[model samples]
Target: MNCDLNIYCDESTHLPNDNQPFMVLGAIVCPVNKTSEANSRLRELRIKHGLPAYFEIKWNKISPAKVDFYLDVVDYFFDDDDLEFRTVVAGKEFLDHDHFDQTHDDWYYKMMFLLIRNVVPSPGQAFIYLDKKDTRGGEKVRKLHEVIANSIYDFDRRSIRRLQIVESHHVALLQLSDLLLGGVNYANRGLNSSSAKRRVLNRMQERAGITLTKSTLLSETKFNIFCWQPRGNRP
Candidate 1:
């Protein structure tokens, strides 16, 4: 009965007409077993880096400066081995003002899928946490969760043991990570008439050599479109 715990956090921005790129950022963290040498190493590394006491390293307060210190600690301990932590930042550009009529669900799903694929967790027990997109008991948030769940379930049944989605405003760690990785995305946005949306599309094509089709663009817009679905009995 080995308990392996993993957590995932993501952030998304949906703005129309604004040149600012819509971005999603995600991060994964795994806690090594307490008895293992990894735990001891983590503690030692924290001490070496002169970071705040272990208990004080909460997620909400982690800024770029803190991340720098933490990564220094991580490098000290796990530099030799291939550590599993990862951060993903995805950006989508908006060209047409009319495109807002479409939805962003597909892009969200695709980004999550990409993140999951990179993490490649084992079949052991795992817990997933998502920053809540909807508050005030909104129906749209409920429907988005269902779509996300169905997509993941379709990809791998029983891939995760439990999933918890809560408001990002309440989760300090998710908020910190989102701010850090999302900053990079914002910096990459196009200037003036140029936009991150266009750059994202171009980068995708150049890296993957997959040209964006009119249908794909329309579909992505459709996915981004707003919709409210009630979270009745679906889990």
Candidate 2:
């Protein structure tokens, strides 16, 4: 990717039929200059935990045995000055596909745009990677990519260029995004059953000094969040 910034995107509880109260779209923004360093460091952190080079990280995999390792990863995210996390979460309470004049599929990309729009610097190139989770496969992924580029008026392909659906297992940074999104989703959804999960949530809360369930300052670069209201639907 001929870009200066790499964004690893992921979402939690974002299915159309899921009973979850919220759908969160999150991205881990890393500077291109540090992309290799970030991935190398994350893989090294995995090795420190005895995880193999091919190990894939995910939120559902959080367990008591590996809680400490997960905690360290969370800390590493904040400790690393080059990494940033941001998300756009939407409440499903007033979700009306018809009212929004779009299908859930369309809304998914719209949320993706919202998640990245505020962070992508103008007059620069960036590559966006989303977890390969779309139901309609490659075509949908391609369309979302074009939609993002078009939204930014990058019709000439000079600014934001690449958008691809990648398997999270192969991309360590993508997995990090997933873990971060999962933590926020768990807390905001009031899931208190998993102690390991709660511990991560507590750590995140301590780091931000705010409810993991609420939005942080818009200028908060380290851990930023935006809560999308029910009536707020894109054109």
TM-scores for every candidate against the unseen true structure: 0.48, 0.92
- Top model number, TM-score: 2
In the range 1-235, model 2's lDDT, one tens digit per residue, is 2237889999888888898889998999988899889888888877999988656778888899888888888888889988999988888767889976898878877888889887776656788888887666688667877888788788886777677788888898999999888988988888899999889888878876678677778888888988887675533
For candidate 2, what is the TM-score? 0.92
* Candidate 1 TM-score to native: 0.48
In angstroms, the error of model 1 at 14 is 5.0
Off by over 4 Å in 2: 1-3, 232-235
What are the lDDT figures for the candidates, one per model? 0.43, 0.83
Provide backbone clash counts, one per model.
Answer: 16, 0
lDDT string for model 1 (130-193, tens) is 7665553345444444555565563453555556676655543444345433433443443223
Please give the distance, in angstroms, between residue 37's alpha carbon in candidate 1 and its true position after superposition. Answer: 9.6
